[model samples]
Target: MAKEMQKTSMFIERNPGDCENGDICKNLDDDGRVKRTGTWVTASAHIITAVIGSGVLSLAWAIAQLGWVAGPAVLMAFSFITYFTSTLLADCYRAPDPVHGKRNYTYMDVVRAYLGGRKVQLCGLAQYVNLLGVTIGYTITASISMVAVKRSNCFHKHGHHVKCQTSNNPFMVIFACIQIVLSQIPNFHNLSWLSIIAAIMSFAYSSIGLGLSIAKVAGGEHARTTLTGVTVGVDVSGSEKIWRTFQAIGDIAFAYAYSTVLVEIQDTIKSSPPENKSMKRATTLGVSTTTIFYVLCGLVGYAAFGNEAPGNFLTGFGFYEPFWLIDFANICIAIHLIGAYQVFAQPLFGFI
Candidate 1:
């Protein structure tokens, strides 16, 4: 009889609350308290995905132009900048949530709190432009991945050099649309889990590719091959001038793209619990792990590709003919890029 009554009460509670000139449970918990339900790993994964993007593929090409020395230097400089910006933003968010009893504070709220009035309006306008740019970049990278897959299949409809145009390929658009729709279907919590898995996959891809690239170099294969290229409108005086320009900016651009997420991660960490030494230790460990992974990736890509290396570092850096891993990495990166777009676009979208 008690079990039957308990089951009936559970069913009643599942439905919408009914009030007949009466009050309700404000906490919405049987014990009358709210609970926090996420860990550092989940937060770290979210931040990492926010940091990484389609930029990972292009980093190698950028590094080749600038030489190895500039690569790490740029990464460290950008890391400091990102960390500062993220911490500032996170501090801005903390107060509003407590004052208004709000669950989350959007970017617009911060602008309104600090700038007020017309400044908020101007900020919103800028966000619209930024969001558009991010979405376009995400779509373009996904299409590129799809085209890469198709070309790899000997359906040699065209050479590997063909550019992927969304207009010409309806199927590619459909595939991308499917991914976007699926992405939307997953709630934020589920999407965060997916982000964690993708982060792990990214770290693994970097480690394995770097390891293989190093092994090959140690065995006497210089791996001097060009997997891809891009043409710019700027006219150079000579191939030497072009090479110099590449040497100056190539690695910096790549490093900048990958390190953009450091700021986001810092923002997340600021909000987390630091009850004991473990929190500080975890933060240090997470940052160190990511840094080492980045260095390994850059080292392997540099050794394997040499100067003629492809613009996308992972291509020839890994063992040849591991088609499954290649496809998996490509897809993982494409998905990761979408999350990067999400973080970038979300703030901008709020302004809109």
Candidate 2:
């Protein structure tokens, strides 16, 4: 064993980039893999892209069901839980010694490193399943946004009374084709540009929604709202109210569900300043930003439409006179989901 150790030390001295396990050394990082150039900014962009998605579109409806008290409360609660857990998961990017230990390229790798055995397999299954569901959800949401854009244009041309119906199948096919091309991207490190663009798109649509809600409130066209949310008897039956409340809570929780990819995002950050530290900061910034947007969109949308808020303010035609702006927002949603689909799908691709 001493002789083996001596030989290993000699080899390491001669080839500093080489590892005992014969991992790749060319263009390698300290961990004998491709060098990481991601900073907290890019990681934050990735987090934003992943976290603030179609889920944000449903916040107004969620708030309507949850009411004034439980709506914002649930949103804040989920945001805190997501940020707290993400910071912990970020530290798991590297095992043994977080700063200098072996890097776990994917979440499952982290699972294997620290919680080896059947648990690794179980975690991997769960991770992939979750990722798959997210991608599917993004696909459907993107298609809906596309359909909304077309439907908005039709409404503008034909008048509000017209049906203006549009099919989602073609839009879904188009989204799938786009993904096929984007999937060709080599890996996560190469996705900073896409994430940045998607992050911007998320902001664009969210801002538009907020602006529209504010306009409605300013115009004094606010819908009926209560402190507790939709009325138990008038808006919905007691049992129905209970079910809707739970669904709203689920929607709020889903809005903050980016922990599945937290470690992968951390893996992309530079080693300097310590990845865990950088990731924690990124998590805070990303989640805080998302929470602020969620608060504005959810609360303002609820204030504007109250119990009558559509499932999606933009796509649901909550604002009709500014047809062009609504079209732009829906288009932005489609663009954002296009990139988000890849963010959530990449891990599954890598795992396979």
Candidate 3:
């Protein structure tokens, strides 16, 4: 009997997955880590939270620069490119064989598995640097949104003519404090709630922006818009127009810049349906959803403000009458960025 017990223990140690009666093994996944509870829905939430960031707020300005002809075209082009590359990246979540092979936990892990040596280090360096930049950008954007909220209220109480100037330092400090607390979250697997909240906030603000643009267009207030975008010498100087056009393209590209965190997001998905298959479906759903929002926001915003669209319609002081709605939209932007900051920052935190 003792010999049989010892053999059972050895079997359990050698094959953890086969240990049906063991609590520890039952709690763990095939990879010997804590079980992953994420589904494609949660994965889509994370992707949406990461993809539709503060960058979406600038799509109006992007479309304004490119105008009717190239604006929609560029948006669609980037959408396709992002979706295509993301599907390919999803397949790389597992090495050699996506389903049965060993898991690659992060983007850097994926790189290390497929292309070892110096390439891994290079990928890590680039990825972390990009993540750092994105976090910094989110910090600034969140502060700006917070400041916009305050300024919107001030303008409503005072007058639009009043400067209502407010310092971003205090807001920045507040945003930093919030991030410091949220940064305590251990990993992507534990961030589903935050991502879901952030995803909701993203939709709230985006929908508000779209609604506002539709209202503005319906009110019959039209600004000049050319098929080729802002006129060369009339609306802007030759050099200014060229630079603005390039910057607009950059903004559109940046709006689809969540690919950096794709592998990390994929790591949280369960392995039953296969991680790659789940990730691909989530990617398709998330990107398709965002593309629809992007097209609506960009085109409708341009139609509302024409070539004179502000960089960010919410904070750019484009609509002033419905001040409460504007304030709420800005607040939503701030809330969304709070979670987004972590989504991008966790990979860097894990690496460290």
Candidate 4:
């Protein structure tokens, strides 16, 4: 047993402090080292965190813009594309064994190793943009959720646009503060609990939002909307229609922009046993689950609000019903997004 423990220590990550949870290990490699510590569950959380973010809050709005038939069609297409691209990415984690079993540690490594041109720089640029966009999106969403809960008059009349008295900036600043402390924990493996919690919160709010929408629709609270979904409230003519339609497509595209972490999160899985299959499984499970959630949210939100759906479904789910449920839903959103920021940012931090 002592000899086995000693052998294991060679590969085990040396954490900053003793792990409080026997299984959860938060550690860092001082010299940009990747540790193989994550299980399939942990990898799934990271993937889920990457795939589902603040963009989900706008899916219903996207559906409203694209109409029902087109909206769902686009989502299904994106799902298939993301799944294929994800698997292709997982296969890139390692090189042919003849090359001394070399591995591509970051997404940039793969680009530089294989593409070897101006494309490397472009990949880096895109990665930074993705990281920045994801971080900003989560930070903003978290702040909005916090604001929805803190303010008393968040929900009032259905047709009335209720505004929160408190500034969202303060809440964002507070999130940053909390994040700085949380970010100190270095290892992705250590955040297993956090990832699990985020996943649960995601399911929680999605279920609540869907359930309420169904109830409202069944109770005749909402008018029957067309299959195409909602409207952008713009005159349908010339480039105006074309531009907005494309813009809505771009919005849906943003929802699935989770490719940034493919290599890094896959790096967390053990290279033995399941081998190349670890990330494939994670991608399939995570993306599949998120797609279901997205469809439900988009359908339910559009059903309730039709053409009137706002840009953010969470804040605009329903004002009058049980206001507390809205608050609860937002609370879940805020918590999930906080973890999401770390999941997306960790890869950037690793690469840099």
Q: Best candidate per lDDT, number?
A: 3
Report the alpha-carbon TM-score of model 3 versus the true structure: 0.94
lDDT of candidate 2 at residue 99, scale 0 to 100: 83
The digit string of per-residue lDDT tens for model 2 on 39-97 reads 99999999999999977877999999988988888999988889888877887888888
- Best candidate according to TM-score: 3
> What digit string (tens of lDDT, one per residue) describes model 3 on residues 112-137?
89999999988888889999999999
- Score residue 278 of candidate 4 by CA lDDT: 76
Candidate 3 regions exceeding 4 Å error are: 1-20
Instruction: Give the least accurate 10-residue stretch of model 1, judged by summed lDDT.
Output: 27-36
List TM-score per model, in order.
0.66, 0.93, 0.94, 0.83
Worst 10 residues of 3 by lDDT: 5-14
The digit string of per-residue lDDT tens for model 4 on 145-183 reads 898776534445433465546789999999999889888
Worst 10 residues of 2 by lDDT: 6-15
Model 3 clash pairs are none
Question: Model 1 over residues 1-352: C-alpha lDDT tens digits?
Answer: 9967643443244224443333443322222222224356665676566555555545555545555676556556655554445445544543454322222235555677767999987876665665567567667766666555544443234534554333426645755676566555323333455667667756655655566567767889764432222223332235755775565454444333322223233223322353112223433444456556665665566666666556564433233335455566666665666555555554443333
Ordered by lDDT, highest first, the candidates read 3, 2, 4, 1
**Alpha carbon lDDT at 178, candidate 4:** 82
> After superposition, which runs of candidate 1 have C-alpha atoms over 4 Å from their true positions?
1-36, 96-104, 155-171, 183-190, 223-289, 315-320, 338-352
